[model samples]
Target: MSPSTPQRPRTSRRTLLTALAATPLLSALGTGTARATAAGDVYASNTDLYTRLPDGEGTDYARRYRRHEMADASTEARFPFHRTTVLAPHGGGIEAGTSELCLAIAGYHPATLERAQADGPVHDYWMFEGIRNADNRELHVTSRHCDDRVALALAAGSLNVLSLHGCTAAQAGAPASRPEAVVVGGRNTDFRRHLHEELRAAGFRTVDGAEVPDLGGDDPDNICNRTLLGKGGQLELTTELRQGMFGSFTRQGRAKSTNDTFRRFTAACRAAITRLEAGPDQAVL
Candidate 1:
């Protein structure tokens, strides 16, 4: 995808306590039972997956997160609270490239594992990565069914949640000639528009997720929309799009060998988040 000029178009809060209260701590619920499946996922939820998988820094699967905080008293006094949280519910082998993208979008260099800029803004991030040699897809828990306690808590505390996901070109209804595309969705219409504008301006093809109901992150119960503002934004990147962003598609390769495409995509996402932050606080209607 090459950069092109696109026509520009003009583009949540509240019930924080209610969302926090309504979200159950799935980790605390030790029921090993599986729920009825609409997605045919192997596990019922992140909590259920935890029961069957090994979780550690270097295990079959891992959960990682970083919540930015004030550097000092003066910084705390001057800086507004970070209101966005980036999420990758199906990262690593499950949805290759998302883990790295999550890190990059959260203001970190995937290769160096450092802040992208010396004084750049870093938003909160949460990732569930599958590191198994095979069958990693079994770790997947659909967005609507994602009940990871940490993921939920981070999202519920923030005014915005930007989730990264992966899908096939066919799933996105993109033609083979232009398979490298993204579907932007979610309940946060303003944030969604910002993403579309910035991504299109950056030359990436974007499809309206509304055209694909399953890919649309509009469900209020969807984890992405379970934020303080009760809405969030989601990006469903095509496999071709994600593969082109890295020199190699393996887990290690993705982190260590991201290309210009990767950087551009992350930059566009960060830009959209910046636009969202600059806007007035949303009311919890």
Candidate 2:
């Protein structure tokens, strides 16, 4: 994977938010109990998953009425958004840490589009963006299947995308005791490696995406790289790392300042971006 050039100039954070506010949001609903659960993992089985919405109407209601998706969509079309776009597709009870990580990178701003679900039935949900993860629990669309609103953000002029995710250590053959390691992937090797180094400096263990068969991020067709720049990064953090970052072993706490480890991790992300910005022109792959 190589670094790709931005299709447009770097815009201010305010400008980016304005654009993101204009992007359209598609509608959906439903709830399915998760069969899997790990410490710090987010699954819809808990009652708290749907508690945030007005009247407890589930994730769809919040996305439709509370999130102001229509305004986000329309404004997003007006200008090139952030040069670096962060995403957390499995948040709000699917995968913890991811939404928080995206939010951290974006400085608590609405520069990210995180999936909010109390119940969205899905199969192989991680493989695609637009595919519904709720209702009937039948379809599993990959990036090859179709682009969702999140996927369409690439076309809105974001130069890069960084998708955050959480995974079980056992899934990667890692020991339960030390699950603080991370796996970095995506098409932008330079940026990916930079992130890897930064995380290492922050005292967390790391593995290149290529070294992990199950969590490799190099696949071009992977949802991570389906951005406007055609190159992006994906980070798969172990539950241990995520737990420390979120200051909770479950999806119950807020991302407060007390999460020192999480702050360090996000600092590394910002440092990586600064270093990359100083480098030579990236080729738009």
Candidate 3:
């Protein structure tokens, strides 16, 4: 709980995707001392969350359109177009099944060419998770609440990345947007010296966010570090045993850590699921 805690300011994208569509992603990866207070979290506020970011291949077709609203006791009813979008990455390669206009709410999921390797000379540090909502499942950002939001997508040069974007802090989550740290220098200095030697082989004696200005640093392996990292939920993610070979991945306290800031976000979740598998076949207006 250092790095000058108490964050949540530079936020938008509809309040960090509506707090990552109403938080979940494994309780924002929180644990152990609340995961070091979510690695020094932060995120102000504004609320944009984006709505239109289209490209090519159109097939728009879906209808069930309806409208109605009424609130009392004070008033808080506003639903013209709920606007939804889970995780949308792209770079070609995503058309398993889609196309029927689904940005009006949100729909798309295609990312399975994953990779993970590390035994003795480990250094790839992989953690890709780009899941989204299929056509706004009853809004409020559902998917059983975004599987508790967990992000980590990095793989530049050939492209296809994801990372640290679970969003929260509307009330009590943390890191509202992303980027509080992750600024290693020199043309990718070997992917930031292999992420600081994979956290010094995972012990975390002390890494310091670029010398510690506010507590947060370089996390981009590529893909222009996408936005909407969790709000004030802080940070989390860990797995250590090796003592008894519980899950063994190269013992020595097998560590991989984060608090906030680590983006690439799988090219916007494969360009919003290849634009909904290509577009045109949806009907629910």
Candidate 4:
């Protein structure tokens, strides 16, 4: 996958939503002039995403934590890098995005939407939503700290459209597309790999590669906050483009309070995990 527009390509949640809400005529605007837009971090290209400190900005907060770093490769779609950041001792643990981790796997992730299309037909988009109540450390076997996401979006795709993640404090009031399924992703490789396995066992499909394809249209569903990331050994989700899911810049205006981070639904997550860990066709709905 060649790099998208040498410059920083943006995919704002607010902008897309605003456009979608404001310009209802795009779908019928055949030229796609209003909608045939392109997204950055396109299906895995050369890119770098870093995590932020919990206390939010400044050197003091910066001193408290560091971004998890590994390697960089904007390779393919299943692994669309959205550039994630976090605060506190939270979002850490060998995870990508949240704690300051780099591309978790080595080299370019070797899956392409085009290749997948060649292998088989690419079709509809499948979205998933979940919450990571535990911190990267807690989930990945570390003993330091924990974190909570009022909401979390996971990556999983079938033919054409890969999953999209509008999950975060930034996306709080932003317009977001609803997902088809929701699966949690943890910090460690083993944990994530295990989770993927469990999801499959529960009858949900996951892409073997890390790429999410772009189904062109007025919507042009490309990956956004597309995949889970690792930072300073911590984990967090990221978007495909810095462009907001809500149209405004990620750090724009007074930050909106994030929705309830999964604390109230601990039982639900545990139950979901248990079900996946335990049975064959337990149903993940």
**Residues 157-244 of candidate 4: C-alpha lDDT, one tens digit per residue:** 1111112122221222212552222223222233335445654454433332222211111121223222232201111232321122
Q: Using lDDT as the measure, what is the rank order of every candidate, best first?
A: 1, 2, 4, 3
Q: State which candidate has the highest lDDT.
A: 1
Off by over 4 Å in 3: 1-125, 128-154, 171-273, 276-285
146-181 per-residue lDDT for model 2 (tens digits): 244534544234556676666667654467777677
Q: Which candidate is the best by TM-score?
A: 1
Whole-model lDDT per candidate: 0.79, 0.50, 0.22, 0.23
Model 1 agreement with the true structure over 112-207: per-residue lDDT tens digits: 879999888899999988777766655668788888899999999899999998887887888999899999999999999999999999999999
Model 1 alpha-carbon drift over 4 Å, by segment: 1-38, 54-57, 71-79, 282-285
TM-score of each: 0.82, 0.59, 0.17, 0.21
Evaluate model 2: give its TM-score. Answer: 0.59
For model 1, state the Cα shift of residue 52 in Å. 2.8
